[model samples]
Target chain A: MHDRRSFLKLGAGAAVGGIAAALPSAVSATECASNIKWDETRDVIVVGSGFAGLSSALNAKRQGLGSILVLEKMQVIGGNSAINGGWLAIPKNPIQLAQGINDDSPEELVKDQIISGRGMQNTDMLRQIANRALDAYQLCIDTGVKFREGFNQQVGGHNKARAIRTLHGVGGDITTKLYEAGKKEGVEYRLQHYVEDFIMDGQEIVGLKVRQNYRFPDLKTGKTIYIKANKAVILAHGGFSRNLVLRELVDPALDKTLDCTNALGATGEVTLTAMAHGAFPVHMSFIQTGHWGSPDEGGFGWSNALLSIGFHKGISVNVLDGKRFMNERADRKTCSDAIMKNRHPDGSPAYPVVFFNHDDHIGAEEVTRAVRDQIAWKVDSLEQLAKQFNIPLAPLKQTVAEYNKQVPQRIDPLFGRMMDTAVELKPPFIVSRIWPKVHYCMGGLKTDLGARVLHSQTLAPMKNLYAVGEATGGTHGGTRLSSTACLECLTMGIIVAETIKSDMQA
Target chain B: MMKTLLLTLVVATLFTGAANAGDLVKMKGSTQGRSNHEFIYQDGCKGCHQGSGKQNATDAACVECHGEITSIPVDESKLAIPEAHPHKSLHYNQGASCLACHGEHEKKAPVCAECHRTWFKEM
Candidate 1:
């Protein structure tokens, strides 16, 4: 731990500038005028131990800067990234190209993002993601984020088939590896430390006031410690999904009805700390929901594999009339939005019941696995499934007949989805009714191509401050595609790391 | 929020230990609110913690009294909606230190409320 007073005195002694010594005694120390002394000092302080934070720390350490600290508020290291479904949506990547699905480029990826956001996403940020998509993916591989072989799976909302998941199929694998990579590069970590506010030196952010040895949610109970950052403070602490009041301020629909899919520590205060320091925020209202959890599960359960199974191998129907509704093949946001827009015949929000009859199109292994995992609700027949879901029996039977007929012909005139000729009926239906859960926040603090947090009004880089991953917005505007959240983390991680390296050295 | 706010008030007053248990030892409040948290708190916190001026209750402490733990559903097994893991998510099973849903300082998280549909309801 380095004393800010002593450090200031040292700086004053070393530099010709007299203000370094004068400001401590005469003027305020931070934006909030915090009088707390410094507890520790580092070249850079990375918030949140998830992929983005760890990536930044690793990059900073690789640049040969000693004294890099990764502070995580959570008891565990990873934030939502640990619990996230481990799929990186990279455009024009070698995996997709080698898998013979490379018609889509960075341009297409950006276009999809813009279209998904309803054209609200920043073009420059999206273009950067598109152009350097592969570079980011490779960086993750270099950091030991191992993707399973032959597992370049395509997820929803993406126009082309381009995504690779971790071998464990969870963000834990990626986050753990990133943490290890940081450790390998001699990056230090301070877990269970909550950042209370940003320390400002003149107009530039120079340090942070943190709550050391902090309990998870009880905010008022921790030791106040200040840490100075010599070069910069990267706000990679993630988004505000967990903060209900803050979330509702932007999207009023995010009232208690919507459950945040992020970790508990993802409250907006970290971003608010930046905001308090004049770092402008953008798209705080444009939140994104995953829209694929069971009305039975309280939050996002372990169901990424199950969701893929449901979307790819099953047909989704509205519980209202037992009829096929929205294009189930659409991206997660599109499916979730359609569900949110519809009402049940009884005035309840229409629940999407995804049913897969043992048409044998889906392998027995997956069916058995889903059943064993208890994610798949298996019933004796379609009648039982309809009864379980409270859907009309006759209409559901008719809808399945129509869908099965169309599946063989490889044409869905209603939705234009190409269901290949692999689905063949056998017996015994397995089903699960799912709805949307508030998954990700598409809008956040605005940033530029260099991954620096920019002023909301002027859009200029906030000096000595940067944000990456879900903390900074613009990569996603109105919405984000499936498997893209992790991709954004990696892409922004590399960009910010390199930028910080060059800028600090320069 | 009203329920969680009230519950948070209860939790802040529930534990009378030290402010924080330092950087390494993860801290959790004693269970005293609605749902099964009261009983869980007794079993996990009461036996060993016993007002020891500490704040470290864990899943390991949970399994000590309850035997092998897999799920933490608010409702019965038959009544709860279905999921791949439901209450027994791998993140929790694989030793996620504290339950994101189980907050001693607050009501069980809203993730549980999303399906149960009575998140802030006073029970």
Candidate 2:
């Protein structure tokens, strides 16, 4: 590894430093731990309780790790995993093999990912995930996560239909299943325990200092405790899509008005902590924001079903002129950019794009939920719907007429939308006006293919420190394809576990 | 200036045990809860708090103790209502802030009750 570089220069904010640097002002900031007692000791400690964290802890326990600890900052265990849309993009998956679907390979998945990432991603990292897609998928099986069989859907950024999902649709089910599995395997969890500092023995990572019984945003409320790790320390705490200060350090354009799709604890404090101990922070500003989030709801509230259904099958119109300005079936980034680019003359979100579809075109339950949640607008006539949203009636009628005229040709000449049938927009239109919200941070700490956090310039591993999940960057370079994180998380989880196990055995 | 100063990972971490809490190391507040956690509210309180108003118990405090209300539930998951009812909650998981919706001494009302009183039988 090369000499260490400072954190990403995303914006003009304070470079969020490490745990050792975090405390001197707040409490005791001394690295003079030689005189200090080793109050507690453990074989391995994994931070954050998301998919990465649980998988790390599980792998450690399975590999004869007798003394392993999992730490969570929030009152709850699961981070965004419990709330995410349970979609995973995997190549050459068992379900596909069972269905006799050939023409899939690690090379193909890597190609699609690099294409989506614009070649800025870690090809080696992407290659590993694609290659071990089955091994990682097997981890889900060993943990007893029952994925929905015979159910596969294509999303933005993939050249193939290799996505799979759990039968228990909500991320909560996976979180609960992993939590239970970990518990059953004797994996213990300590809630409200936030890791604040890394205890170092010269250049090596020994363990970490923590704040016990911590509450979110209540900075000065918890008590400090230090522990030692004899084997290694792994970070799987996820990203900081919600940590505006740290995010602003990388992405200066982040204003207060934008919303986040993460849980309250998705704020990135761990990345800074890892960096403090000689890890390189990369792609700090490359945050992933999507156009489907509704301003009407907060958190990652469940309108995703409508957004997915409506974005493809529906026509989005400018609220002012009632015209379709973007391809309804464009990729996620394009769809979001089109909505953000076309604005009103007054500099506000002009023509607040409205996605509308006939009743027969979308899922009834999803539509009903959207309507009940007050996110979707329901109306019987095109004129009535335009009136309901204050849209110009004449242009809407013309747009619909033109859309129906183009439907029979089985082609979207305007937007190049890929569809089997160009279904005509009929009466009783269900519409939802959507906008962009911060979803995931594609950039994070830099790491190697083995999931070891590395020194950016030197390109050397930080000895015993491993970073995984969204916390480690280089998997998705420019833009992440939908359903890819699930595969990435599981794959890295296995790699880190196996690497540590072999190292320990040696 | 940053190059001159040594960088240590700002994040903090502590581990007693995860799957096995092997030999758990207790921190300063590990044994404690929110604000004077030693004085069990269930034991009725010390003095001034027993009467009412701002000095009394809160919904946030209640959820702090009974954080796993969803798994156990209030109506169905409750082992015994008289005590568990005080710990029962219906809206904590749906992004409703525990402090925002459940206030006790300030007002004996749940904020979710304003819009969703009809939704929950407990309300």
Candidate 3:
């Protein structure tokens, strides 16, 4: 039996200090001995029942692997993916082709992703995801998922209008459809089964030490049980945005004070557990704050979609000076950076207000609901809007007037924003205060193009260990563009299943 | 005087029984609809708290009394958005946890309200 100190010293590297240090002290003593009694075994085991996890299971089943199991630590099935805005950016998709938009190509999409990612993305991975994007989108449709009728949307940072949303406009729609499809295919799901540690044999991964009937935020609740996997253990556990300790370690600026948009179960324990078992970490410092988050709401609120619309149709102004700060159409990272930098005198976040004219063709239903719920306000005049948020009325009017004048020419002279789709400002504006919130982690276990997790020291692929989605980093570099997360998760999930099947045959 | 003394004794015994029912330690709020209800052997604390506070209230236990989540009647009139019944949510479907919104001993705010509206106080 190896002691806890010796095992951690041997298994972990200096690169994993942030993850290792952030592990709860109570669970630090729980170590997985190499030869543990197995309570159960399966052909394949998938951790975290989000888009990536469910997609991997379905693909594995389709590839003729039997006895697949999907484990979700949360009481609910979908992680953040369920509640996410179900927009998937795919270049040259059917919707785009049908709409006669022929300018888009996978290369063009990759170029935009690279730009949004600040050139720090893995080009190979980005190209791979971009290439298979259409196929991934088709897979969702085949699995009974339906996109919104009429037209596709161009999310921020995308050069083309390539993103398609689900009919219900929430990732839950896609997740529910996929889950139902997987269930019909005999893919087993177990909720509240938390994967705590990986079972290893020599340098290869073997199985998992999981806690069954686990309760959230209660480490001492569930009893420990070991489960064996004959084929592979795929990790699609999303990110650690909700894990304050890990977030603080990587970027001190992103501490507990900032509310996150992730589900409560997105604590990143599986990633930390994998790191404790020699998986290499990548891009740990690149955390993203959503620029559309509202201070009045919690989690991913309705204001998120409205604010996205505001970026195209309106402007975000500073409450103190009533001046436009940055390009509203800029990528999430750029917008968040601008908002954070435009702070109050006390160093608090600026929490700027985004407003668009009520009659500007923005979705009326959403605006009405937001106004009714008090998530957004619909003021009769510009003066009332200024007084509501405490902005100087003169500069507010001047800023809107300048925007209206510049936008008529189809270009923003001050901020370099393209105003081709924008319209002139009108009365009866709808407004919501916007602030940045910890939204996603663009970092996790490092993997090869095959989605096989690499070892920290040897830099070799850890046999029988695979990762996909936000659980594995280097896909989106420094900042992830909106609507691309779904694409990456679906693409990498299929790639992982194929890799595992081929490896097993060999 | 004798009648008053007997009534007080009975009230004290009932309160003590409810407090000592199971792991009521630090459990807050009323069980709403089931307040002041008597607990028998078949459906006491062990009914929902299967392992007794070690695990969350089981969905199966909830189903045993309330019925399958899909079939459970939802009063649309009680909902903020009539279409978004928390139990039969299009997103969660039947997988929504009863404990996520409802608390037995403690007042638990619905997780749905984190993104939506605060409609039901006891949910």
Candidate 4:
């Protein structure tokens, strides 16, 4: 690997002759003065105050990094982690410590993660995350974030009730707790500043050129500031779930289709920035898909009403000409792809609708009051409902009759419905209009076990560059397990911080 | 009789001039709607616009100057609001404002489906 000091010298030369040189002399003088504001140069500079960045900072501090600086882009700290349902799936965690749930070994966790990855996961990275997961889970508890006990249940792949969920609701609560802890520990947080690009010393990254927003009495302006680092720079800037260009570049099929619950700033610019700096991107085709809902009057897609109804274990069918096309019991991704494939004979995109009976609706309503409040349109007769939705009445009637006649039980023989609930037998049947939409991006900048971003060509560490959270790739492998995204952010954040601390000590 | 006629003419001229000037001021005031005025006044819009409050006093007064405004009705039963996608929970309580997420100058609602097609289909 290239030496870090030589890299800084080369960067200084490039800065002098490049864009920094073209600026008006007055502006250049300000930047020079800003660079001198480094109170203490630490071994690592963590970029982002979200879960990953905070975790890295805390770990680095624990590991004895001389000083650490956390730079955040938003006005607040906690990134996306602050906005999520804080469920960290640590198979055997403190709840197990408190309630005596059976212990789960790292090997078993790794095996499950591998299976969930469906053959495309990076084994090395998955192994590292699984091995260190328990420790990370305990770290949150020790730091005063409370977790709910005994409600652990299986979702999607894992066999055990290993999901260690935060009592703080989801992401927001956990992030708040972490933020308070970080503050108490004296982690310097710089908010409302965006890291634009890395300062390169030849092939090694030495620091970052950040743009700070200046709010004046009559004007709002952004001024570029430089931050120099002595150890490493960790990127925790989240994913490209909202970036259409990046999504299209990763998978053309997913272009113009994905729906993200992510914040408006959840663009994959940081990943692109890393790629530009010679970091290789991996698994760009792995897009996560699941149920999503749209407003009836129409504008944007909202949360999946199905999940809101606690129908996670049920089957879903894509009906065309009043018949099922794919297996309802199929996994989320498979079901989404099947629904997208359902088209009319004329090759036009078919409006495949999802059907659930009264029982399913009730179950959903019970789980979430919001779902109950939204059940406004319902009808007893299929013919009348068909007219309302503009579907052919005769075809819909015939399809429901055929479906009702064939099965001895409520379980749809053609498509396996998980719970075997009865069909719409009573009055007031419900149907939701659904079409395949883009959901999540599983591809990003490739990082190693320690969450350090690597040089694309050399496979060596870029002197002061690190990546964590969704911006970094490797943990998900081919496909991601549900709820693991939040877990990865917490676990990897800690790992990167510890690594930076150890590096500084060495 | 000539003096009386002259007095009438003078009164008429002054009234006509005042009416013409008032029309211009009313037009400027109506350009800002009630919500806009409230936002401006509450958010220190007067700090820059100077005398906007006196010009557009009430919501109706603001609408009068701005012309007719169409509002998307909140269908309490729908999971997602029909066209506006107003965060129903937040909006129903009047706890939030349109200007909070959408800037005050926006004349059209954001095309959420252009990027989020799964959630939005051209109706």
Candidate 5:
């Protein structure tokens, strides 16, 4: 890795030359700051257009920070945030209070986050997320994000029913509004501007070497130019869950053939660039594979909607044993790990199926589409379901009978899953195979409470360099809970803007 | 030597400008309505991409020929399932970029499949 000291020496050499050197024949991200002529200058350059980046730019511009610019590497804005299920987990919020879930607090929320993250959380950052959770939800509202009323559910790993879905149940509803709000606040967004590296002045980040109008997955498409950041550069470019090389680098156990739910642009280049500049990477090996992903269809497909419904209304059973495995409503890591353990002797995932009754009102439209796509099987009876998946019919019937007995008492004798309003599953079942997709990277560049990127060598804050959202680590340590990434991103966006404003005044 | 150098530069520039177009031409019968070559031949690289600047295909370019997506009526009879109306969506009806899902050079599945199994064929 290129150190700050070597870049400082290059800066010194460029200063001696006096004239800006022409860009070298070979495209390189690491260039001496002194030898570069900035194509444009912004007071603050937010390197992403997701919830974190746009929120930072919008909040910073609202705070009267001048000349803020948001850069998106893809042709589109929002990155993976555009396609996410817009479920923001906030504790003791008005939504929860209205629903009679009055037993949640910021302390409780942080405790749950730490529990899900396997106790390796940066407690301070988790507290920041917990404290600002309501504020983050309000930010979404103020920015014109319409939350669906009466759609709040207790997602896996959260202690309470604090997760609220957006109006359309997709995150684009949030991002499109955030983008529009940021634009209205005079925050300029330059899409297709791929930030390659930080242009450093000694140890401090001064500017970025960006490729403008860059085509995705194409290395030498856009014209490389350096843009000076007069105040700060906020790195909110998200994690590398889709990048197979980086995924294999940290966790080789993750199958190379596994599908991902991330936007095609969710790669490791930007995070890797920050690491090259001495930003410390944390929790790199703690990648989280989503338990809801369906093996039958590509990406985060229709089966996801059904599997979530199946958690509460149905049962998830291993096809081999024809019996329920782990709790369907367990934490994401626990569920994914449980599914992974039920592998064939050849080391392939058993690809267990989650099934709910066909008449269940939970996510009907989603199930219809999944069945149409042939990813979900809608069989008439338990015998047909067992026969279709080639499972033992007797064992399947016995498992369902056992689950039915527990449903009446609202108790699970086997795995201790919540059985609220769950009835005995009947005929005409909707069954879909469950396979783990490289969903979210639980690890990224480590940041302090102030959202400043920390340097690996000195363990000090990298001056004028900040990070937020999934791009920064330690908020959710080993594993992330459902709906919290949105909360963390929105919260960090607010916190980073305040921190940047304070730094500017100082 | 100078003539040869100048020729190489011109060829390299042209090659870089339509590098992705080469990938499009190879996928002859893969597209739904028209063959990949027909779109390239009739419209040219600049038709979809809009310029030689190596930028992505603009939504405006797509809409110019395809018309406004949201306004197009889906015949419910032809669809295999209900709610298969690909054009009219809950979010960003006309505002979403066409290139977000429909890739000419690189074949991309309908991004709706990313979340829902809305098995709408690629336009």
Candidate 6:
């Protein structure tokens, strides 16, 4: 292994050599007005190549920034944006031009966002995001992003079904289009680079130090590169959804179960780096946890699978000494919390088994088949199924019998099972074991309405440091609505670009 | 002096034998126990081996010689698929690597399809 000092020496040497090699023969007259290192000085430096980073780079170029640099830590350009369900929820988007969807106004949008945010939302921040959503959506459309039409519906708190999705299917498609657009606009995309930390001159962020992946066979040794920016550095690196330490630091309760769909690089390292440089992280405790999958299985939890299989409409009985505990039809989070409470006497990890009868199985089968063709469903007598699942047969039988007896009334006195699904007590019973898992982190580096990173307590904007996408938090107040994460990314990307442009011009 | 020389030869032989055995095992494992001729299929093995008529190719030789495997068109029709689902397209084109999702690795093939297929029920 190379010594740290030796590595630094090599990196410094390589950086100097690389600069000497790539530096323009003479400083071009059109270069930004700065005497900083030629390799370091760019009018705008975007610190990710996801939806937000790419958007910022393209918009910055459009805004006449002399030199634009997009640094991607991954080996490729698109970040998590390339791996997500490509849904962009813009309430009252102009793409509604072709479709007769309900038109939304900025005030209504603010109202909806505030309601979804549930008093945790910064109203001013939300208002800013709402006001510019249409223009951003239109901009995306103009840049070859085809918004899917006709499938608009309420996700979480929105009063109307105005969320627009990409025809490219999911996040990756939207990101690819944006990346292509950025490339067309001459955005210098550097991949396989990890941003170590922000270069700080006291409180102000001046530049960033990055390390390129030298592990490739072609490259002899990895090198550290410094990027100094004349105008601004936008952090579109995404949220800390996969960082356990950061998750535990922010919310201790989340330490128990926080399973996210974010990438491995989503370690919240960028957030910590920002905080180390005096950036405040807000809404740390606000986490999104609705879907519950099998703890043993590594994917979206079983509760979501069960919901997909119509289990939400079935009777859910929490068996404690052969007795029902909570109402079965309680909200998903509430149900998950109850299951967590009943894990074991010593508070071991809880695994709640969902029981359903033949009718419930049919409903579940319909839902599951619609989502995915591969789902293992078993049909057996209630007692036999209970025996197969290792649950006590007598108690489970009694629980199902009672649940079925109550089902005729069409109202569950125990768990408030609504939606009028049949009682799961008869032959051909099915059960799925599930537990709660951590999903997403709603807290990140504190930012202003313009997506500018701010000092924690003072609320002062960090100089030339902007944050968009999941890297910055302040948009989703306490809880993130279902599809708003993708929406937040695209809207904030456009917002940050426009803000940077205006700031530069001023 | 004779004992020391013999011991040195023994140690050196053991080390070299172990390394050669490991290499052979790895090569066999990669081809799923099939011989080089059967595993490589067609003349795919020749570009790396070059002048030699040997079927087996070294990792270094493969990287140095046939590094541009995608450029050697197996089929042009495969590339003409319409861009509908980027996630699916990434899976189809990149295979299984980080680039299938994150997008920048040039050499590593993206493996979104293999992993996501195993875990993601929606996929």
Among all candidates shown, the one with the greatest lDDT: 3
Question: Candidate 3, residues A1-506: lDDT per residue as tens digits?
Answer: 33445434443432242332223323433444454778899999999888899889988998888899999988777888888878889888888888989999999989998897888899899999899998798889898888888668787888899998888778888788778888999999988787766777755777887767766655444666889999999999999988888888899877455778888777787888788778999998898887778877778877777876788888889999989999888877688778877677878776789888887745677687778678898888999998888899999999999988887688888889878768788888888988778988999999999999999999999999999999988789988988899999988878888999899989
Per-candidate clashes come to 6, 39, 3, 20, 0, 26
Off by over 4 Å in 4: A1-44, A61-67, A74-77, A97-100, A190-192, A214-221, A291-323, A342-351, A359-377, A409-425, B1-123
Off by over 4 Å in 5: A1-30, A99-104, A150-154, A298-305, A308-335, A341-350, A355-369, A381-428, B1-95, B103-108
i-RMS for every candidate: 6.4, 7.3, 2.0, 10.4, 3.4, 7.1
Cα deviation of A462 in candidate 6 (Å)?
1.6
Model 3 steric clash pairs: B28-B105, B28-B106, B101-B123
Docking class of 5: acceptable
Model 5 per-residue lDDT tens digits across residues A301-336: 666777767788888898899899998888777887
Taking the tens digit of each residue's C-alpha lDDT, what string does model 2 give over A359-423?
Answer: 57555777876676576778889878878878889998998888788877877777777756346
Q: Output the number of the DockQ-best candidate.
A: 3
User: How does the DockQ of candidate 6 come out?
Assistant: 0.07
lDDT of 1 at A52: 83
Encode model 6's per-residue lDDT on A1-506: one tens digit a residue: 23345445443443321211111212121222233342456778888777777777887787777688887655545766666666666777655544676566667767877777789888897777677777677667777776666666555577766666666456665676677677788877776566655666656677766655432212223455667877888888877666665566666766545456555445555676677667888887676765455544333423465644435444444434445666555666786577666555676654556655545446553445322423334547765655555557688778777777777787667666573765446666555555666666777888888888999767898878999877877677877766666666767777777788788777
Candidate 4 whole-model C-alpha lDDT, 0 to 1: 0.57
TM-score of each: 0.69, 0.75, 0.81, 0.70, 0.77, 0.74
Candidate achieving higher TM-score, 1 or 4: 4
Model 5 residue A171 lDDT? 81
For each candidate, what is the lDDT?
0.67, 0.67, 0.79, 0.57, 0.76, 0.59
TM-score-wise, the better of 2 and 5 is 5
Q: What's the DockQ of model 4? A: 0.04
Per-candidate fnat, comma-separated: 0.17, 0.00, 0.53, 0.00, 0.33, 0.02
Best by TM-score: 3
Off by over 4 Å in 6: A1-3, A6-41, A75-77, A94-103, A214-223, A296-309, A317-325, A342-350, A355-376, A417-431, B1-123
**Per-candidate DockQ versus the true complex?**
0.11, 0.05, 0.40, 0.04, 0.23, 0.07
